[model samples]
Target: MKLLPCVYLSAKQDPTSKQNLSAAMKAGAQCHGLWVANYGNQQTNLRPWNRDQIEPANPVPCKVLIHQYAGDIANGLFDFNQINPFLENPELVIKRLILPPA
Candidate 1:
């Protein structure tokens, strides 16, 4: 079972900025998935630009997989997450997370 190489984009580091992504690529990171840790709100919705905003600067395209949307849900113990629902091929995405590319 192979897992995708993922990058964690924290809110403190401005997770939504392209500069962060560029930096990750410059650092020799094979980022296939992004784990965005932004405790903005307790909503299970995909970001507005997550669907069609692909940075041409990246070698391998990376997409948001698990989003840490809310924190301290139960006495500051748990964090809420949501899979990006706006992706083109969600099944393929899931497979990519757990399986190596063909």
Candidate 2:
């Protein structure tokens, strides 16, 4: 399964904020479409703007989709060790290490 990019907006966010949507697009979201999370079954569920929001200031390289995952499935469980391998790849440029230096 390919892990496509999708923007999940909550009730707190401004639905008309182009800047926020633009950021999501620049971050590599697929299809220029956004999925509203926790929308549940409702006739008034907010939908993404129908215009193009996939344009970004900086283009990303290697537009490949990876694995799929659901936030609710994992819940509160997290394992840094498991994800460390992916982050440790030499090809990945280190932006800012949030971890405290030894």
Per-residue lDDT of candidate 1, residues 1-102 (tens digit): 122545656645533455756665677756667766765555444445443332222333466766665544445545665567776666765565675566
Q: What are the per-residue Cα lDDT tens digits for candidate 2 across 32-66?
A: 22332232222222233211222222323222112
lDDT of 2: 0.30
- TM-score for model 1? 0.48
- lDDT, residue 44, candidate 1: 42
Candidate 2 segments exceeding 4 Å error: 1-5, 15-17, 24-32, 38-102
- The lowest-lDDT stretch of 10 consecutive residues in candidate 2 is 77-86
Q: Model 1 scores what on Cα lDDT?
A: 0.55
Q: How many clashes in each structure?
A: 0, 0
Q: Candidate 2: TM-score?
A: 0.22
Q: Global lDDT of each model?
A: 0.55, 0.30
**Maximum-TM-score candidate:** 1
Clashing pairs in 2: none
Candidate 1 deviant stretches above 4 angstroms: 1-3, 14-28, 41-61, 71-77, 92-102
